[model samples]
Target: MSDPHEQTHIDSVGSYVKILLALLVATGVTTAVARLDLGAFNTVVALSIASVKMLLVALFFMHIRHSNKLTKLVVAGGLLWLAILLLLTMTDFATRGILGVPGK
Candidate 1:
């Protein structure tokens, strides 16, 4: 039996090339989507596509997929913090007009 400490995954060059191509395609799609007016959904669609592309780059290009569980947990925690910050920012922006000025 092989030692458990040895590295199990060795990604090939072709996989990296494929990921590059996928990122390029995602960029093209983002550009195309931006050209068409989709009302408020435009932002949703664009962010969704961007999120997918970011995940691909983070998982494959950054070698996060091959990392240990602790590393994965740390990454997940960081993403969670980011989401919280974004949510707070959006909430503040959305509620700006609700507050009335004393002079008004």
Candidate 2:
């Protein structure tokens, strides 16, 4: 049911160009964000921008957008695992120094 050429060939030259442009834009935004002093919200903005860049890389350059079911499943599983690790790490970080001695 599927065309053979579609599976082996990259999406298109345009797609490659798009990927390049996206990378450049992400990099530019990252640089700009780094220069700004957002205080408590600086990390939040950086993470949000980085997440967008990560999504673009994952979906386009990684070819996950046109991949098979198994590939999609693997990507999903990896993301889920990463989420678990991040959740645990954040929890620990949040708890640390929460009940520590005063003026330690």
Candidate 3:
């Protein structure tokens, strides 16, 4: 049997080129959407596009698609930590009370 540790699942040049083109198109879509007046939905749209781009980069460029389960778990943990931090920051801002002058 072949060694389990041997590198496999190599991609072709065309695959890389396709991913690159997809990333470029996603970036263009993000730029165009940013110029619109979607108001509250604007953030949602931008984040969605960004998430797609991030996934493409991670799966293709970073080789996360072919990585082991342990590596995937580590990446997930990092994302969870980031989410927790953002949640705490937003909570702090949302719960803050306005300050006023003592003697106005």
Write one digit per residue (lDDT tens) for candidate 1, span 18-97.
99999999999999999999999999999999999999999998889998899999999999999999999999898988
Clashes of each: 0, 0, 0
TM-score, per-candidate, Cα-based? 0.84, 0.76, 0.85
- Per-residue lDDT tens digits for candidate 2, residues 10-75, read 588897898889889888988888888989888898898888988888888887888888899998
Judge candidate 1 at residue 20 and give its lDDT. 95
| Candidate 3 structure, TM-score to reference | 0.85
Q: Of the pair 1 and 3, which is ahead by TM-score?
A: 3
Off by over 4 Å in 1: 1-8, 99-104
For model 3, how does the per-residue alpha-carbon lDDT over 2-77 read when each residue is reduced to its tens digit? 6778567798999999999999999999999999999899999999999999999999999999988999999999
Q: Write out the backbone clash pairs for model 1.
A: none
Q: Look at candidate 2 and tell me the lDDT of residue 58.
A: 86
Cα lDDT computed for each candidate against the true fold: 0.93, 0.86, 0.92
